[model samples]
Target chain A: MSTQAIIAIGVFLITYAFIVTEKIHRTIIAMAGGIMMVLLGIIGQEKALQHIDFNTLGLLTGMMIIVAITAETGLFKYIAIWAAKKVKGDPLKILVVLGIITALGSAFLDNVTTVLLMVPVTFSITRQLRVNPIPFLITEVIASNIGGTSTLIGDPPNIMLGSAVKELTFMAFINNLTAISFFILFVNIAILAFIYRKQLRTSAELMANLMDMDEKEEITDKTLLRKSLIALTVTILGFFLHQLLHIESATVALTGAFLLLLLTGEKYLDKAFLKVEWTTIFFFIGLFVLVSGLIETGVISKLADYSVHLTGGDVKSTAILILWVSAIASAFIDNIPFVATMIPMIKDMGELGVSNLEPLWWSLSLGACLGGNGTLIGASANVIVAGLAAKEGHSITFGKFLLIAFPLMILSIIICTVYIYFRYLI
Target chain B: MNVAYKYDEKLLELKETANGDDIEFLITLFDSELKKRLIKVREFFEDNKILTDIHYYIHPNNKYQIIVRKDFYNEFLIQLFRQELLQEIKWR
Candidate 1:
């Protein structure tokens, strides 16, 4: 009830409201809030600096650079063409194959990058077959979220969680969530397939035409593709060995990005740098300071205490509560700040004598990742894909996307709930 | 036969001339010409069975730039405009 605490809460609420409304650039809102927090004496410059998670920022920037360079190589296009050929242009088959590819790609790479690479090609292939691209695009968005839940580096929330909880390793994430992610992917595809069954039929001639597409022709620069692929591979390998090698994920990612840049020569340095999303990075910076303000003011501790009290100190109930709450909240708001705030609160539970925090972490990851599929505005990837679709004259309205995606997202979360109960709660 | 068009690997730039010597008239003529070319390009792609889409942007300086996905088709369109069609269009 201190004035400073009240002011910090007020600032956080206003910033979050603007972010959800999306009336202005979130980066601007967040930066403004962080500055307000500092100006109000809620936190000092040094404390705010400590709040920014540079590892998460570095990893995001590095992956974005690599993806930007690799995207130009037409590798994504090539994969799309190849997948279309494999399905022989059958609409349902195309959906399943492309969904799996997107899911897998998102598991290893960022979801936004995965979708950015996939959506245009999906549009082109679907257009060629004279089918609507909406179903496939929606499926990809859902799959990207589910797939991203499977690994430490797959989604931003997971990355934040992994960076915060040192005990959570790359292998730990893979072992814990990969199976559930695949399960959700399969279920998601099946649901989409049934919904779009009528559109799944295409003419034999169109199938022949798709099969005739030369995937190699999609590659604009084979040399750059090779180099980018090599860099990505090394970075992934580095992630697997990060615990053993004593290297941070950010270091691995940045090294890989720079190595690829060097290998490709300096001609692309400027363009690659330009491709890094500075606005998103700044948003993260602002959010960190804002959340740090809550932590410093004892507000987060109070919330943690209330949550633990609500669950009556039972780990199972607490994990389940976190799962559902995180899922529903993330469906409407950006999960990054939510998770950033929740991490400390969850850690506080451990500090308050709640042993075995692994399940809580998994629940948070699953809910935050899969819940993003509930609405078009739920995740950054979803919004961008919607924007791209609209630009291409096939706009996916928010209600239309939510109609299909929300139920499917809930189904995925239900599956996660089951996995958490059987695998951890029992 | 002396009409000139500029060609690059991905884009074909066509310059417009107006008959009325009025800026508004010139802009209208340019827009109509751009629309006509876009229709033609669409028809051409339809005939050729090309799956790609055409995108265009008007430069700040009033040059009409048409972009195509395939390099070969871009070159082909440029050549077709230069050799066969450019001189037949009215210019002022």
Candidate 2:
């Protein structure tokens, strides 16, 4: 092993440790690690810059801008209230509906943003019914992660996968992962509904009061809502057809963001940009460079060679191994950096011996995304929801979340194991 | 705005209007002490992470408008009493 590779490994491990401990802000740690890679002569600054995946960043930013503006129109709140009424204010039924709504929202938007939109409404609706909000919040967190597994643009891991591998397009993700993800969502929510049934009961009078709510009045601005819907529809449609349009996903997303800005005029430009989650963007930037150090130093190839040898060049075993390892690792640590390192390793595996990489990619996506439900700190969405719930005096303790979510996460991986074995491994 | 609950006619006045599913409260406080209490009420909700339930708008001449969601009404009143803005809350 070269000295540069050794230094790169040291930097990456230290950075990973700090990120997991969460002693300091993750953004700072990741950025510092990336800079260390450059400063230590492991990777050049320009080479590191070349490694940054702008497509993922662009998609994230565009969707954020669209959601930030759309939120002003009160669309998400309106939908939640409307869905609650549609279920006749039954807490159990509303639990399922909100889970489904949250999943759908996360399918199209970012997971954290979708949860942020859902959390407040979940609290409002649950408070109105005088039921405990913890179950509902837990369900949404799990659902958001599952939903984010279904599409190229849904989760950061999947987004990074799509950008790194050209064959894994938006449509390809929908075709391969969406159905399985939804199936898992149904199974997970059903169990949640059963477990929380006792806590979900409400008085008939309270139910009646919820029924009397006027969902239409929740729309704060009809004109802005209309414009937002138009832009959102076009952006989603663009994702569906980007492959045929011969355009990159980043272009589609940026075009959608700019189109919305144009429609709303200058008033929304500043607000929309301000809400773009620049910290997350920079986090991705730093991670890309940090991983590039491993790639440039040939460490990824060594790891890939070792992994391929361990599996004896069998695609089926390699796929299953990757899936299980990703799920277990992501359950405890940040999946973004995990996936960042694994992408190149998997690519190297393809070069070394693995003939079919499709199954491997899907397994990675399923494991990494679903693994987030294993703990409260497993995903950004989970942590955010827990923080908000704690602030509201409803504590979702790490152990409490792990007890419920870890078992469900194991069940989900079991199902994925079956799906991958039958659908791809066979 | 229709008068919903008036703690004191001269010092604190609360006028309520129903906007869709939420109750918009237009609170006018002639006394600065009442204003301080109202600010505390806002902080309580904010601290609880229920930000959308209340909005505080400052106007000239010490006028304030706070729109609260109907779901948070009871809790809001409880907070007012907790802050000593209300001597007691009665069930109507």
Q: Which one wins on DockQ?
A: 2
- TM-score, model 2 to reference: 0.87
Cα distance off (Å), candidate 1, residue B79: 9.2
The best candidate by lDDT is 2
Clash count per candidate: 0, 0
- Model 2 spans > 4 angstroms off: B1-92
Residues A1-426, model 2: lDDT tens digits? 999999999999999999999998999999999999999999998999999998888888888999999998979988998899899999999999999999999999989999999998788787667789999999999999999999999999999999999999999999999999999999999999999999999899879867867677567689999999999999999999999998888888888889999999999999999989998998999899999999999999999999998989899899989899999999999999999999999999999968999999999999999999999889999999999898777999999999999999999999999999999988
Worst 10 residues of 2 chain B by lDDT: B54-63
The i-RMS of every model, in angstroms, reads 12.4, 9.1
How much lDDT does candidate 2 score?
Answer: 0.89
Tens-digit lDDT track for model 1 on B1-92?
23334333133334443212111101112333344554454346534523334322222333433334443444445544644333333322
- Per-residue lDDT of candidate 1, residues A94-179 (tens digit): 89999999999998889988997788678767766768888898889888888899999999999999889998888889889998
Native-structure RMSD, model 2: 6.6
